[model samples]
Target chain A: MFGIRSDLPLRRDTASRFVVWLVMVLVFMASLAVTVNSYIGVLIDDWNRSVTGTLTVQIPIAAAGDKASAILVNKVLDVLARHPAVAKSEAVPRAKITALLGPWLGNSEAISDLPLPALIDVEMATEGTEAVTAVTASIKAAAPEAVIDDHRVWLNRVMSLAQGFGVVALTIMLLVTGALALTIVFATRASLAEFAQVIDILHVVGAKDGYIAAQFARRALVQGIIGGAAGLALYAPALALVAWLASRVDSEVLPDTALPAAHWLTLAALPLAAGLLAMLTAHITVRRALSAKV
Target chain B: MALGRKKAEEISGDAVGLEAVGLHYDDGPDVLKDVSLSIPQRSFHFLTGPSGAGKTSLLSLMYLAKRPTRGNLKLFGENVTQAKRGRLAAIRRHLGVVFQDFRLLDHMSAFENAALPLRIAGVGEAVVQRNVNELLNWVGLEDCKGAYPAQLSGGQKQRVAIARAVVNRPKLILADEPTGNVDDTIAMRLMQLFVELHKLGASVIIATHNESLVARFPFPRLHLDRGSVSILPPLASSAEFDHDDPRG
Candidate 1:
């Protein structure tokens, strides 16, 4: 115990600095995960509920004077409405199309300059992809000039991509935690080596191995706890910033759905767990090193 | 020569005894070979040899740091060849060792370092304070009791080491080159302290290269030549002066 107490100052001075840095890094990563994950959760939920039953119809004209295109869109809409599964349909006005294109084509530019296809937004009654596929096939057979898109393919792809990203973020967190553990192990080993002669002297004076090992363990525990707390402290604020930044994104592009609370809780638990793991790793490593000697 | 405990007596009691002991490190040359000697109860002897003559290695064996590759080593009358780790630790609690380098813990203050043996043995705080202070004062280091090892001079650190070694009044005390780093006056004083300990019934073995010390002290000399030990005659005649200090 005295051996451990004697190393308090040196342990605090060096270990605290390392712990602070580790906490900062962990907090940054945790906040980033929470922020990015919340956005992904929102996107997935929106796609599953709102976008899954929706489809779009576009009519492209081969000539400058083609009233047939508009006529064909109306026909497709009528056919879709008669089906029992079809809920509603609307012809997207040219103004809405121009507004959607305003980002790429400046608002000052005339819409007439470009030959834009006339589009009809369609809503179906069912959620499954099979219903949309069957309805699309019927619409295509009736009007060859019309193109039907149910968005299920792209939305599925987007969901898969988002999940993949979440996994990557989680993996990065694991790697960072592992690196921190390795760092703690190395530092503890250095400390043990530095005090090798001291340990020998103590043993000669009838200090048991348990007595010597306790000193190292105690020092590491204090370091681990303090470092872990510091890391968590940094993590909280960074996550708050992420939440703030997420809240400020233009709702027109990224909607203002409340962030997922579970993700934030997971972020909150990270530093504490990492700190404990580091402490345990340091203790075990030190004990093993000492035990291997006389 | 005042052989406090004979080899036969040590065998009958729970005390340390070596018989034809030899030690060699793994994948290294032999460090100790065929060294047979007995240190009886309340006896004082000085080990004399040149540098790298295994004085420290012999002392390490005395402290149970390593086992002999050949021959029997008995501590407290139990054969230590198959001694369990727990039993070894228990035996070590009654032993004290002083290193030439002092080996005081750099992290602890002088007082704490000196009190380590008692602390390891689970002595109470009050007892520790009393004994540690007296030992510190005996070594003339009472004023710097709170100072760290790094803050003290080489000589001061040596004194602290000596104080720590003898603080427990151990059954056995082994000092390897204890006076190597001190002045002559300090060295003699330290030797006198060893003499005082020997008089108090603690067996002591001092290993040094100082032939002058061997000449001055009328004690048995164990000479090491190329990893072997040979006992020499006592420097002082036994009956010259019964009036002179018997331990000295």
Candidate 2:
């Protein structure tokens, strides 16, 4: 598969440079998307394992009157603290809640006067969704009007983003694969046209159509490998910079952004995969082109 | 080799048999009309024709490069008029053709060019190198073995093409003006090589415009004019091809 010698002068063609560059750019984007998609996989697993079952207990100011809302929060916190699954429980101070709303409404003093729900933050220790159902009854017994959020609001949004990005990355790789195949076909035909006379001579010398096609296949394979390696070289640094930026973000919703070391080996194999793709595509292209002759 | 799934010697009457063959390009007048020919195995013939006399076209047919537009064509006694492409390539393996343009691959060295046929036949590298070196030396191209076509002279390129054609020792040898670019001395030497192959078991057909060169070989001639053929008889007294003579 790695044979280099060929009867066609494909190396002399200027289109090789164009093909190599196109493949390089395409492979770089594909590697980046694929690696990011890989990292997102870890993030999705983390979200499912640790974050999906966490809950928030809220006492709306409307359901329980403003003064009663404060009392209802105390009952819920006591109920959560007594539960076996609850790892920690705390009531969010009214001043802190008002401060969080300062960005959209006004200053803390202006927003503090308004009615707002009493919020209790609970961290559940267990990893199963059953933990949410087990504690729901206890919290409701303490305060019947208590609203329990399994944190599904932001959890579903982030989960959707991760899965959506994975799908988008997959689509990008598909487009890259299609474009790479087309590039090989066009380049093979151009190389074939450039060496048409040489091929005719090979035919006269009793060389089979497979022999001639193999020469072009080798050329395309070489181009694919070189271009793939170069593209991966560019992608490594780009991905590192992205990981660094992602890790630096302070949002609580973001998952661990560090990529594992073993994935580099998988990414390293992309060059050979690209080479095989180029070889197969080129072989089919040349055989079809030559079949039309005489 | 026969065009069908048959061995070379299994089905045999003539090496080549063409019955009322007609050919033409798309929507064009017939380049060859009602062309009928019968050449026995191991026989040598010269194809003589004017510029547009379809010598190369006829050679193309004999080597199975193209099928006749109409009528029956046979190689090694197998009818190939309706044969498959793979069958045509199988038969082509036994036929060697030296094109008029000296279509040597510009990328390959002269030695590689000559070794191409043997390599395609799945011969080992050692045998390819030995036989190619021997043949290149015979064509007086021993020194230029490592040279590419672009680096070699016109006559040198023609010699490389000839070496490539004959290196396989095929059953039939066809050349279109194989000696067009070389001097009379080298030309005669090259023709002597062809005659040697003919002496062994290969049928040979050479197309040429040089009458003096034709006068030296005692082979029968197939003369073509206006898309038709006429047979020319050989000389009454056969003359030997002198190996040492500069002018034979």
Candidate 3:
């Protein structure tokens, strides 16, 4: 609309519309990849915080009537409480510990007859492995039978998996951007060829290369916006369905998939970015084609 | 016959000046050669020749559509043979060309096709509307303003092309066989439109082989034959060559 309103026809054929739809699908894929990556990052952070600087002390059942095991557990708790690096220490009640193992060991009479260790949960005042190591040593000196489990091995494995997912998501985003740019270039060349006579008329009428390029750029930008919005519309409902499904599942098994407000805002910017990419690609292509003419 | 009356009174600067200009296609034979002439400002001339006489090629040079292979050409007093491509558009804006094909865009209506020049020049919308409407009406196509080029007859499309050429009141108009597709009556009407534009201080050049039309008008002639040009005298009166004209 900003250009000279001539009878010069714009692309309205099926081929052109297919180009727009292709761009929409590419943008949708890119947005979905980024959103998934963000969610993975949140999950990793949650897992890390849940495990960092925390230790579980387990004392095996004593040869006597459970009195010796209770005394060893009290000795481990006393050592953790007095340690400068310890924040809070609590003895896990037998019922709660039994409930934690209910899914694996079952709640039948056989589970009650089995010899179970007394467990003490310890929260450390300082983070990192060094503090946890020092606290473990102090606990071990008091109760030799106590074993300290800091959860570092499992945390490392989860982080490694999250990083691998991040790499894949990044690769997907790059591929989508590349594909969108190529589609725009192809569409511009096709449009230029289709309207060759119209371009000649415009040139004869004294329209400059910049002016012609602006016409194409404006048209491509509008198409980009429409396609981008359509892609986002599709992504939104899919994201909602995924969130609903995630909510129905147990959070301990699967981290919460619902994206935060900041991540949604980030995804909202995808359409605008797509529009800008389309405009720039169209402008460059048109100018390059016109430069070859008289 | 009055030969070069305007050329004799050449006190004013020429609208177009060519000195030994030549043109040829890529690795092809020369299409135009050694053409030297000056068209004084506001004068009307007819370029007459047979087909394949490089009439369109010569006009293409005048409109900056092609650069001459050799020699100097001045348009509106500026040396444009070597002008940069970026600067050529400004000079081209002062020229209006009517192609033999009647190049009206098929997508635009008659009014929009005619309004192209003014719009390209960034004229105000109100002025473009008024000028385009008045010109369409003057060309006798006011009723067809909303019609596309495909919907119009040959004569109507030619008229639309002419209207587009003069819409911005260009300083020079080069029409290549503007009436080639129309009847005698429509051709004469189109010539009259050019005459009116010439009277308004625009130099006009019409390329045609129709001797009858040339004899009907006493304008000077730049006759081209075998890639060469010669300036011929204007007929003393329309009656002198009216009987000898073959196209009559």
Candidate 4:
């Protein structure tokens, strides 16, 4: 802790320091909220971007024609397997498909009797090169009914939308953090001006602006860190509850997904970043205010 | 050179000097003009004048509150006209000021106010504690050390201000009407403290309208009238019939 300028030793009271700490904590929390939301947005965008290049081959047939359809799917898979960019290919077994649709279709007799497609989920190693054009040409000539659902056509647009949304969210968070920093700076400047007489007294007694500003900046930094931590603590449970709620919903049209570890890690980094940002802004503002006075 | 030798003597001198020093508030008429004088090292002096005689204005210049419009101001033998902020701060540490209003930080206690000068100097805690307690006891405000400025009486506040000013043992002490808000007995006692400080090697410059008090102390006088200073011939002990009346 920095020494306050004055010959008169002020009575050390913990109450005032605590109040300052509480205020900083609240500011820190606000910063944390912006950080977590921005990070989550970033994670979703990354996931969306990663999943775009792959395609699935679905062959639907009447119940009587299922055995023949399986043979045709095998022929199409053979052609796809020979492609240079095809990293790995696997056919999603009918039993696994039935289990995936279980919650939506339930265990009803009607759903059990309904015929389903024989689907082959394919993945390509091409990071930059489009493997779909060559693979489609090979598969179509081998099996007439084989449909290569090249996900790129729609995934490109979807991933781009996700990235655009993340950018907008990030922009909003940056703006909010900037506004909070400005508010703290303005408040500190006002406090400094109001105590001009005290400043003059301190100045004549050899108190440097750095000394005084450090006291103010340290207080503001602590307040921001505490605020961010407290807010994050509160937000953690709320976010968990929301994630829990999201997990309880039955999967039908929407895919059943779990948030990645990277998303959680990003969320955790928010509060600390918020605290540092608040401290930096407060430090700069207080130093400027003191310098202006001198 | 003559100038270098003079500068050396000035730096080692116990007091400061003002040469043709004039002050003006941004675009306003001059508040002080053509004031040239040297306060002898370790000497005590009283400034006397009627209302609005620029006593406070003159003091402000000495304390470095407002820069002068024209003239050479020498503090501790250093020419302050082109002094950097760092140099000015170094000189300021050797100076103390007591304002008329007591100008104590409202947020701090009386003890804190006194400890302020020490704290600014970055004195160690144990040393600060010892010095602060001694000064508080000296001012007769040990019991009220924890009390805030608003809670203290006028005389007590003035004593605290004096204690704070002298805490650093500054080379010069500037007091603006140190006894204005107190009674005669308290005022006289306060005057005694200034005398005590002067005896201990700190040159004292007090601005006041209390002529009777000024007469009681046989010090050189600086009289300010119409924005200029006139050094009256130093007063001798009064031979007049003054033994009967303490107020006189």
Candidate 5:
């Protein structure tokens, strides 16, 4: 459908060449922003899925023995077992806790004797923060030094960070869209000026305004398709490289984000949408200009 | 579709009719003043005038290139004085115009230029190729079929223009100085082409200062002077309207 040959010349004009490159650049940037926004959405979803209804209990060493820390963790575990909101609880192994600290402190024998806190993993059968406050109170009563870490504060911080990136991506997309429309309008108008005599000749030869408009619109649509394809082609490897970079980031606070399949479909369709938009823009611009003429 | 029963009945089958038509660019004196004429279907006429006479303007009006500033005009029994652009374009489909400048697109080959009207009419590709090639061959541009306008000589471009104009077999053919750029032999050949088209039911109008062409062809002449027009019968032996003749 995008294969219509342009009655007007395509490759000779500088304005149309600039139009193609501008479309390519704008579509590339817009796709990146849109997909990044999509990725952030997935990350937020993963955060909600992984962290909700789960709590971590940390019993401080207080410069005491690991045995004492274990005793306090057992007390908190007993409290959690009796609590209605807690479906299950298990003390995290000391070796596992030490290994978790392996990032900051090297796995030397001295690091194991550094008196780290005891940890417990808690899974909740109920929803929301109200049950979290009740469990905190019960655990505090059993062992005054024990604390329940619902991770809500950290989750809230991470959620806001993701939302901020989402907002930036959305803004970038909006700006890129505006820039693309204006660029197309500018290029189309330039073409109209350059080919005004051809237009007059066409009209004399019994061509309707729509016929002339179609000649230009078809060229613009083809240019859009070519530029959009090139842009997306560049974007694919860049996105893969981003995914690779993300894979390199090993962190306790952040989960790996994978763009959803639906998002990939949307990105895949961007070039066609750009093509249609260019076609529509050229059509309307020419129609309006012809309307004002004899 | 009709103004009224009587009004529709009053409409004529002339290819073009103008009554008291006046036209001018914005705020300018009328280029065509109080012009009235009727071109009957399948007839031929030569439009003749001195330099600065309104021959080109009258041809433009007849081809619906511009609307008359004031007056009533009709084409093919339809009132089109102030017709919408779409209606005018639809009417223009039946009109074939050969401009003075031979306005072939510089980017298109002579073959492509000849195929323009048919393409506009949505003719299929096979038909477009077949018809355009035939027309180009007949116009003696077969060797220059794929040559662009800039690559062709003036006479070659004029032939391309004429071929493009008549390719669709329009009901009316309007030519403005069509043979101005060619030798007498080629001009006669081109005029023969128009005569053939007229025989095939096309109303032909040629606007030119070529008195010899007017005298050679038996067609009546519509002579324009100072934005007004008068019908003049062919005078095969007279140069009364010839400015350079200077004979009484």
Candidate 6:
């Protein structure tokens, strides 16, 4: 006789099922967006560290063949090595250069006929664009046919692309949160309307508004937790599939898709936060709706 | 402080009191006008009127569901008209109401519906079980305790409503058409239940148009007509009560 019984329907009706499914999908998308954004941020930082404070020098191949071009490349390397801003410099091997072009130019006997430029790789000790400028002048003076390429310009473009991706990810997360809130609001209002008589009976029986709101809030909290868990459960397999597909590609083409163990904790909190949001939203909604009634 | 406390003690003697209370819907005509009356502690009264005569409206005021548009209302000596929304729950908890339409929660069983008032009052589980079981047994609903509202007959639903109203042993009971849908035997049994409640020091106010039932019991009645109310003595025939005359 003292057992607690639910005044509202306990079944997985259409409206409630729809709300749970919608919340799950929205949370899944939000989690994916946030994870992707974090990965891109890490990639940008890694790329920036590798590309900054570095320069590449290219010497045009002379009609006299590899002997003349090699002389110009060594002269450019000697100039870079003597410069105060240059940390270290080395002449790139012809085999390494050929391998760099191997993806584009096939390893056929005819490939040897094409005249490729000799290259020098340089690492700078001093920071700033001015240091690069000074080293470029020194290399040009030493070898007139040589061209200096400071990677900062290309790095800036890549950083801009990463920033754009971050912005898009953030916007998608915000949209998902908004859609989740609206879906909850709609579902909460519909539940309140459907159970108006039950609510009125509670009211007449001396149950406070908080008591009535708590009933709804508790139901919403349970649904939210279930939906959130379902979304997160599907997320693991989806992430694994993505990592698998990414592993099949060349590492040079794609950034590392594997997330750190610590990042998983953050992703795990998403569903929990969604559940709390649903509970709080339902609490406020039910109270507001009850206050409007007689 | 002593004088104020004495005055409060004196006011606490009344179970329900209204001072020139008036009620209206929006800007429409008054449903109840300048009605002043007091039900002494443990008194029982039948509120009688034709359909649309505002019997339910007057009962609404008594149960704290609706505040009078103009004038003061005191439930168990508390100024409920001036009470805040949060304070209303505390005051309402001391009063029980049986609705005319039998507003039972369809999803809940008869036992759960009967145990609602005690649960709301935060009674302990053991006490709730004991009191609710005994009350259901008295109401002849012990066997149907597991049955939901949809599965119960109209008389059974009415009994569940009554059990809920009295479960908390409230200081006052306000019932609207408590026996309108039941058979004569069940109706007599329900009236006997109200009498038993009154004997336990709870003032009972039952609104009904059943003249035979009114005649069967020696309870005073407050007759309402054209937005006005007049008190009639116990055992007084309703036929002798004039509808047009304010002085009855």
TM per model?
A: 0.70, 0.87, 0.88, 0.78, 0.85, 0.86
**Candidate 2 clashes between residue pairs 3 or more apart in a chain or in different chains:** none
Each prediction's RMSD to truth: 6.7, 3.9, 5.4, 5.9, 5.2, 5.5
Candidate 2 local Cα displacement, residue B176, angstroms: 1.6
Q: Give the least accurate 10-residue stretch of model 5 chain A, judged by summed lDDT.
A: A250-259
Of candidates 2 and 1, the better by DockQ: 2
Clashing pairs in 6: none
Instruction: Give the DockQ (2 decimals) of all models.
Output: 0.45, 0.58, 0.58, 0.43, 0.63, 0.54
lDDT, residue A197, model 2: 82
RMSD score of candidate 6 (Å): 5.5
User: Tens digit of lDDT per residue, candidate 4, span A160-195?
Assistant: 666676666666666657766766676666656665
lDDT (C-alpha) at residue A100 in model 1: 90
- Candidates, ranked, DockQ: 5, 2, 3, 6, 1, 4
What is candidate 2's lDDT per residue for A10-67, written digit by digit as tens? Answer: 6578755688888899899889877868888888877776666577788878654776
Candidate 6's residue-wise lDDT over B1-248, tens digit each? 12244466535658888999999999999999899988887888999978898999999998877989999998777677877766777667778899988898877899999999888767898999999999999888989999999999998999999999989888799999999889987787777778778888889999998888777666788999988889987764445433311222
Candidate 1 clashing pairs, residues 3+ apart or interchain? A23-A231, A27-A235, B5-B40, B14-B76, B15-B76, B15-B77
Identify the CAPRI category of the predicted complex in candidate 2.
medium
What are the per-residue Cα lDDT tens digits for candidate 3 across A219-291? 7887888888889988988888888888888988567745678788878888888888999999999999988
- Tell me the tens digit of each residue's lDDT in model 1 across B1-248: 11234457554564457888888898688888877776666777888888889988888887888878889887656677667665677778778888888888777899998998888777898999998998888778878999999999888999998898888887788888889888888887888788888878788888988887776777898888889988887676655423344344
Residue A283 miss distance in model 5 (angstroms): 2.1
Off by over 4 Å in 4: A1-54, A58-75, A81-120, A123-133, A140-147, A250-275, B1-14, B82-87, B181-189, B237-248
Instruction: List the TM-score for candidate 1's chain B.
Output: 0.89
Question: Could you tell me how far off, in angstroms, the CA of residue B222 lies in candidate 6 after the best superposition?
Answer: 1.2
Cα lDDT of model 6 by residue, A214-260, tens digit:
77777777777778888888898998898888888887657664666
| Model 3 pairs whose backbones collide | A7-B108
